[model samples]
Target: MVLYLQIIWLYLPIGLANIFASLSRHIFPNWDYPLDLGKNYRGQRVLGSHKTWRGLIVGILAAFLFFLAQKYFFNHYQSVRDFSLIDYNSVNILTGFLMGFGAIFGDALKSFFKRQKNIPPGQPWFPFDQLDFVVGGALLSWPLVPVSGVVILVAIVLGLLFHLLFKLIGYLCRVDKTMI
Candidate 1:
């Protein structure tokens, strides 16, 4: 149970990255610079207008801030340190940046596939939508903080559950039009 908690704590930034990216749409409505710059592959949009520079920036920034807070907690709170998977003291901001970048990149990559499949943006893609960031964050951070396969699997499960919970909350709060 403690190990599971530790994994959840460690991967929280990845979850936050997606949340921040979604929130960025509302926060910076005017700054809609698509990552793909309106390019097309074959016929479809490369990544759609939803994947924007602002979302990436805010997502990364959110993860970075959360990491800094984690570091502070590691230094000041025994409970936080107890749940930590890595020694927060030894890690730096780059860890958080990589996590955020990896997550956003993963989502963007998924978006590319979604475009290829003719699945419109904001449409649910089932498990892929929930697990892309988790896999991306884990793969990108593998060299920096290697963990067992079990840990990775647990992270995926937790991420999926959390994504669904957040989506339901968004729907109930009227922030989103649908729940996935």
Candidate 2:
């Protein structure tokens, strides 16, 4: 049980990367530089205007900050270290960067596919929208972390649940345009 909790805790930063990216639009309203820079493939936008540089930077930075906080807690609290998946002391910014990049990149990759399918931005893509970051983060962190397949599966499921819960909260609070 403790191990499961630890996995979910460790996965939080990765799972929340898309949320931070979405919130970045509000933080930097004027910086709407699309990552694809108006590029298109097969007569379709490679990645819609929503996948901006600002969101990517902010998401990665947020994840890095979150990792630092986790490291600080791990150093100061035995309980944190006891539940950690990695030695916080040994992990560096690269870990956070990979996790964040993987997540945001995953979302953008999904957006590419979503565009090909003619799905509009901000529209939910069902489980793909929820699981993309989980799979991306887990795959990217696989070489760096010592996580088991079970932990990865659990994290994916937890990510999906958390995404749905947060979407519902955002909708109820009138902060989001839609709820998945």
Give the TM-score of each candidate: 0.93, 0.93
**72-177, model 2: which lDDT tens digit per residue?**
8999999888778888887665787888888998888899999999999888899898888888877787777777888888888888888899889989999878
- Pick by lDDT: which candidate is best? 1
Once model 1 is optimally superposed onto the true structure by TM-score, how far is the C-alpha of residue 57 displaced, in angstroms? 0.6
lDDT tens digits, residue span 1-180, model 1:
888788888988888998899889788889989999999997999999999999999998998788788888999999887778888887766888888888999999999999999999989999898888988877787666657788888888888888899889999999877798
* Model 1: pairs clashing at backbone N, Cα or C within 3 Å: none
Global CA lDDT computed for model 1: 0.87
lDDT of each: 0.87, 0.85
Q: Where does candidate 1 have its weakest 10-residue lDDT segment?
A: 138-147
**What's the C-alpha lDDT at position 88 in model 2?**
80
